[model samples]
Target chain A: MGLKIIVLAKQVPDTRNVGKDAMKADGTVNRAALAAIFNPEDLNALEQALRLKDRYPGSEITILTMGPGRAADIIREGLYRGADKGYLLTDRAFAGSDTLATSYAIACAIRKIKHFDLIVAGRQAIDGDTAQVGPQVAEKLNLPQITYAETVKSAEGGKITVVRRLERGVETVEAPLPCVITVNASAPDCRPRNAKRVMKFKHAKTVTESQAQSEDYIDLTNDRPYLNIEEWSVNDIETDMKWLGLGGSPTKVKKIENVVFQAKESKRITNNEEELEAMIVELIENHTIG
Target chain B: MGNLFVICEIEEGKIADVSLELLTKGRSLANDLSCKLEAVVLGHQLKGIEKQVFPFGVDVLHLADSKDLEIYTTLPFTAVIVDLFKQEKPEICLLGATTLGRDLGPRISSALQSGLTADCTSLEIGDHEDKKAGKTYKNLLYQIRPAFGGNIVATIINPDCRPQMATVREGVMKMEVYNENHKGKVKTIDVDKLLKPEDLVVKVIERHMEKSKVNIKNSSIIVAGGYGMGSREGFNQLFQLAEVLSAEVGASRAAVDAGYADHERQIGQTGVTVRPKLYIACGISGQIQHTAGMEESAMVIAINNDSNAPINKIADYVINGEVNDIVAKLIKLYKKNSK
Candidate 1:
């Protein structure tokens, strides 16, 4: 039994640098203005997984992501950076899923890929910053999970050790095999793409993209296999249909509005000794100041 | 009766300060919803915990006593909470947004298939309208948190989920007054069968606490230098000002990332949220993330070379000058005033 390490990666819109056009008419995200990149923290997660493969020579590292078909760009980037395999879970049925529904789909895919030693995810996705899906998938799989892991101490003999970043300090702990660990930004920074590997897998395409390319019927490059991730539809996984999408999701977005913070007009009271005392008393009475 | 569940976390027998803060905050929410405030304590033979929780306003305390539960573990701790939530349907669940809370709250909430809001800065009771029933429900718990890189405050509510959950950062709420005569009931839970050696997959071999030369979080007077603190030598000047005031040193995210100071002393969204009585910003550009964390400080005095810096807009008093000159002047001023 060899070690099979899989990382859950997401290509999110560049939220840190959101511009005016980042919002649509409905106040939903206008993803067009946002350039998609491998989520910053997920890069850290992928680096850790790559390091694991580095330490244990024969271990296989696969990158798994769920997004639109355009997300294949991330898979190619993963391949260019030494992942042995890439799996993309994309379907129109998976749209409008929140963190819970997203986790259900990812967990189903993770379970389908049996005999995996460890799963790595970024502490939280930048888009929602919910920090729910990673741990949620771990719970669904019924595995012991370590979150905010700063470093992986060891992974051997059906056991894993890591240092979790705490508020005041860090706690070092070892968990049994088949555990889920969410890597924090404090994890060692990711390595740059391997140019040789990039040249080898740059032409890799998804099954749908490849089929589309075949219909166009023009071979652009003869470098590497057009590696398209096996896209699975709703019927691909064994899950309760009732618990899969909008039906299974118990929560819904009531509404999203631009929250503007504005300071209230202040009736400036003179800074006299008596006024200060009176203001303090009034503040205490109103429960605004302690 | 619906119980307001307060997940009280303790470190070394003494309940964590944030837990008390949560208890105080929970008291109002529980009262607003007409529910009983319950404290859920998990540790190894902890004694006198119920007595301490009284002033914080807990009515009942659920104690889970076990040696294995002494150290924090995701498996057993989460399992115990899940079972408790199932057995007791709490209307609102509160946890301190500490390291342990952030690590455990999401897992438990997800396992129960409920909504869990993290790092909430403000919370209150409001009216939520039911879409299906087309009626307004009064006294719905409102969980307000900073989002969009802390650009604005978004209000969140768990409409369908029975227990409205939120993990608030420490220092965001004030602790209640402590009274000696206060009292509450403590009940010990025996779940040895549910928790076993296999459940304890994670083991802490050795725990080391870092020695703090200057922990800004607890500091009363903090001299915080930001990106405008030109270089390492400039930060040292702020440190000197702190030393003269007998205060602690702090830095903005930019300064910390620029390697001017250690990350431990960072004060912002990605850093520690501080509410010191007096906060002095030296040459710091007031980014939203930094302002979001420190806006609650009692008195803010911003010293920036740029008179128009955003930090000045929110500052109670703004001193316009170079950080070096301002820090040097402040150090000299402190020495003169103290002497």
Candidate 2:
């Protein structure tokens, strides 16, 4: 009675803590300046999947992420926490993918990893903030979706209940198995990496990573089959060439402009009683504030 | 019909303010394109919903009043709107970037293979020429939004897609009435014919949607804080200052993410946009994300220990001081001066 769960995750630039150098003078993102980490809400999604695995004994969690070869880091990170396995969906064809094309690629990968009772993903990535991929993936796969989920109330009798944290309030909803659920940040933070699991999975690497390693490392992976993280490309999944990349994307970026604020002629006020009182008096007289 | 369509959202049996704002925007966009402005509402007890939107200059109102459509499940609503868009072939489609609209908009776009831009800050009708393809698209909806963590503003377009789609957050567009006497035609949808049994798979077990207690959007004066506030305990001074000035408390997304303030009070690209008469920004460095929400304030006062804080660039008065000390001083000075 073990349920199979696939958690869709991403390695996104840490946009939340963007620095002055995070953007280039050319108005493009300076990706090298931003640290790439497992998307925050995706960790929330992982925590939900882990909780479900705890409730359903023997439930297996698979971390599926789409990015460059280095995205394997998040997969290993997932394994170090509690997931049983991971897959990296990487290819040149995925470059310049908007949410729709990204979801199409992920949905195709999910189909290849079929036989799952549930699919989980973060409500939105911090970088894009579109919050579109989860529902789009559900539509691409023709599955029911519950977005903004704060908690998984239960999963029993072939049905799952989730509490969604909406803008105004919360809602409790139930959908049958084999559906998509996108977790919100309001959900509990993911549990810390397990020491034992980390020791066991520290050497996990994708095929590309394995090729770059020493022969001794390759031998270790052969001895430990679980160390191999699956890597899939466009050829690995059945996909239409029309829906694979920038050409497949319906939306196009016509222009991008760096944010430059027009400086106002501001009056500088010292932090003293006299200046502060004088400013307050002027505001009161002008009716700007009482 | 190459009309401009707005998908209306309902709250407490009334048309939400965001929907009306979009209707106002749709009216103008439709006029620019010389096309009709249409609105779609799906919910129960929506008998007089047209009355709510007609003043916004909607030329046609499509209503699908059904018990199943009331609470807003994904599948059925998507079925109805996707079905409607296919038949009508709208030139542009807009929806409020709320929980309901974000949930439904992507599904419809994916089903129809159309482009959708989320959380747009501005929408304009313009022309685009693809230099490589030697093609020009006229009157395309420019979906402008702050991207890459609000570091840059991008203009998105759907050159080849039918029914260019975009979602704007509440308050991003102003809600204005086109005419008090404006009237529109109503067309009821046949939900039963569109929805299959599988569409009813998800069920709402319970729902508790309370009106937001904080009214920051309409507040004329806002005392906003940021991550520099240090902690929740540090925010008490801001609350006291807001009370003295008869202002509402707002926060930067950084402050909200730091757990120093509530999410409802967040002011940024991702949060509520406010244009208060006076904005007293304390301890905020003024990232574009935060500034995009409140930069439209009539007057601004920036108080931070860092004199070089980015917020000072936009402020009418810049005070170099600690947030707690400066806020306390402002509260005391304002109280004494008023008396």
Candidate 3:
């Protein structure tokens, strides 16, 4: 058995370049104004995990994501990129989940599944950038954790070796099995979606969900719905309701305001030799250039 | 009154410089809050760290010395800190936003069920009526960080959570005061074998440390190129200029994505946030993401063919020209002036 690795992925809005109309009157992000894409760094994490699978052949890569129905796009992306299997954890109860609550649900789902040799996640989700979920999951799962991993040097004989990017430099550490690693952007770029693999797994889905999608729109009646992903609700996860959602999230947004730059043109010096020298001298005197 | 806690970190038995930086910030916060400063050191039979904390203005040193705690693990670090948080209940907890602190802070806060704000640039104590109580004077710690990709500054407060938490980026603050008269107490905590060898899912098999070629975060001068550089060859010119000037090379988000250089050299909201003395942007349009990271630099010189670009708006000197020509000229000029 080569290593079995699982990657937890997320689909987030591209908030880096939002327009003036990106915010609604109620002061919440207008999801419509933003285009949804797989979180960029999460793709890096997925790529790192897939690279591990490639090195040690026979290793199976599983992708688990918790998002809305449309998040199935990420699963398609994952499958296209050589993930052996993709599982979606979707339900209405998981809506409005903060990092803590979301990590709880994912941990429960992971606990329900079979054991894996390793788990990987992006350093942080762009939407929140809390960077809390990965470590929190490791803590909840009782696994050793390493965040900001740029490269995985080796993994063999129940031992995993990786390079950790610290502020000043990089530190190489080898941790025991079943460790959770958070992939930083410094890692290798994720490979492009493989065309042949996409075609092969195009039809793959949970048995019931595939059948439901196969049904015609008119034939859909007031009948029982399908349980697609073995998704557990807040109760199904054996979680306290008080420890979920906005109620559980201690941080509150008193206000959400768009930051506007008050452009103050201090002094625009020319790039001439004298002017450049003078500007540098003045900046140092003002303690701005230092 | 609780003392400010500064967690000391060491790699290969050498004290990390950022630990000293945190102690400096902690001492100031302690003075503002009218409390003493404390340093928390955890490692394997490390007794030398105690003497060092004194120069850093630590009034009390909490030591957790053990063999199992040699390498940083989530369980031991969290377990030890949670115990300290319960016993001490410090007013503020600050950690360097390094790899270890990023991994450890959240778990500790989650275990304590407290609020933690990560990657903060500034902090202060705010005197306001307790929002929870509506009309009671309370000293709430205000943790401020650049959010929305450094376009906005968000001030976060943990009014209810004890030990209001925040992580500061390395090199963003000063080092602690090294006063010879600084006297404090050192209390050693026992990290008993609460965790088993089997419980650790991940084991350290081997370790490697690669010395970085360029420590951009600590560099005083940075020469950044962007997509407007026109070609990959043009970016190479910027690098040549960086070599001549003894400056770190940087790029905008588009430039990095375009394969001009590695992602580590990219400077912007998504990349490294930097504030160098002289930041020169060549052939780059100033998008918000790119601007957010470099806007804080002391003197920004934007060289772009298009004078109306946003880079021109924020730059102290807007060189309206082609980047390749301008960079080549600047290199020639610098060489001549140096002689």
Candidate 4:
């Protein structure tokens, strides 16, 4: 029998390529300035899932992401890369969520999806750099988790083996199926978007998105059910209001300050031998370096 | 029962440095809160582990020794810690943001429905008055960390959650012995009773913990490169300078991402924080992400072709020149002077 996989991805502000305009004058990040793209590491997680599907020819891969309506783009991107279906967990109740609250919402969605042999997610998202969601989801689901995974070696006979990359070394571990694995950047980069797959999923849209589009687009989705990406809100999932949004979040932001460095008085010196020697001599004399 | 806790990690049968660092920080926090500082060590053959942590001013040491925990596994370790916290009701819990802590901290925080902040740069006791809620929270643990790709700093607090949890990177805090003669009480945890068979679902087949070849955090001097290093071959000049200065080699996150240097050598907000006495930055533009880790260095020197590089702002001495040429000169002058 083929395996069932759930890949968790996020659409994040491109923090890696932040330019001067990325920060506004008030010292806050200008969200409008940064381009939102599929989080780099999440793509690595998707690649691992794709690899597993390749190994198990009959396996099906589903992409699940929780964000704003625009996050539907992540689902279409996944579809263009080879995922069979996708779910967009979009709701205002998910706003102001810390890692734990975010994990709770994602876990509730996973329960709704029900059957899955494995779950894969990036070790961390660049926007938050908190590698908490994968393991927290596992805890909420009461399943084992293998984090910092560099490669998913094999999945067969209800068991999965993964190579984990740690700070100083690597370890290979085995866990029974229906577990979570957080992929690290060391894993292979994801394959680029397939031309045929892109053409096939180009029109995929969520209900919220189709409502804003022309009637023809709605008709297209009705005719081709595959083109209608699943969108879920607070009402769609079994959730407690207390655990849905900012109220359920245990952590709160007390303050945020824009990074500003105090400029020190630096002594300028040329690259000439005389100036270089003088600087080196001063450093050695002061015991700064010897 | 309400106390401060530091979850210690074991490396090669000894307490890890990050854990010791947290204990040092925990001792001060405990003193400020007028509470005891407790520590927990869950591993196999943990005999006499208390002797290692007591010097850091830990008031109580909880030990859970079992063969199943000889090597760190997620489920069993999480089970033991979660079970203990339910009974202790710690006011604040700190863990080293190592591979082990990052994996276990979230699980524990989620299970207990508590707040957890990861990779905190600073932790302090502070108060918060929520005008909207018409309430005041006294002595909340402020979890301060660089966010927004290191373009900003955020202070996080878990006012309502029990045992406000936070994780700090390995070298962000100093590990100082509170008192060599300090002593603490020992509490033994019943690991078998707490751990269920389901906790043993994941099995470790093989683990190779290599002794870290680069000791940058403890090094007094560091020669670091950045994206401007151009290629892996360009990094060789940094190694040469490091060898001459008897210093360790480090790299910016950009260099590591470019595959010019190893990830372990990355020095930035996302990597190892360092406070070396002398930091020679070669070809580094000094983004906040990179400078956040090394800004605390006792002295800094910048050698970059761009005179306007942000690193030049923090450097004690700035030299505008090609990195390759300047590094060669520094090496020669240092060798001659030392000789």
Ranking the candidates on TM-score from highest down gives: 2, 4, 1, 3
Error of 2 at A129 (Å): 0.4
lDDT of 3 by residue, A1-290 (tens): 57889899998887666666776776555779888888888899999888889899999887888887667778778888888766777767777665666777787778866679999999998776779889878877767788888999888988888887755466776788888889987789999989898666555554445556746521332231221233334554566666666666655443334554556474654556666556545545665433
Reference-based lDDT, residue A254, model 1: 47
* Candidate-wise lDDT, in order: 0.77, 0.93, 0.74, 0.93
Model 4 chain B poorest 10 in a row by lDDT: B228-237
What root-mean-square deviation over C-alphas does model 4 reach?
1.3
List DockQ for all candidates: 0.28, 0.90, 0.33, 0.81
Worst 10 residues of 2 chain B by lDDT: B228-237
Model 4 agreement with the true structure over B238-275: per-residue lDDT tens digits: 99999988999999988998999999999987899999
Which prediction has more favorable DockQ, 1 or 2? 2
Over A1-290, each residue of candidate 1 has an lDDT whose tens digit, in order, gives 35789998998877666666766766555668888989878888998898888888899988889999999888888888888888888877788676777888989999898879999999987766667778889988988888888899889989899988876677888888898989987788888889998876766777677777764433442333445456777777776765666556655544455533344233333323344345445533544333
Q: Quick one: ranking by DockQ, best first?
A: 2, 4, 3, 1
For model 1, report DockQ. Answer: 0.28
Chain B TM, per prediction: 0.92, 0.98, 0.87, 0.97
Provide the lDDT at B190 for model 1.
74
Could you give candidate 4's per-residue lDDT for residues A1-290 as a string of tens digits? 68899999999999888887998998888999999999988999999999999989999999999999999999999999999999999999999998988999999999999999999999999998989999999999999999999999999999999999999899999999999999999999999999999999999999988999999999999899999899999888888788868989999999999877799999999999999999989888988877
How high is the lDDT of residue A283 in model 3? 49
Q: List TM-score per model, in order.
A: 0.87, 0.99, 0.83, 0.98
Judged by DockQ cut-offs, the docking class of candidate 1 is acceptable
Model 3 misses residue B339 by how many Å? 5.2
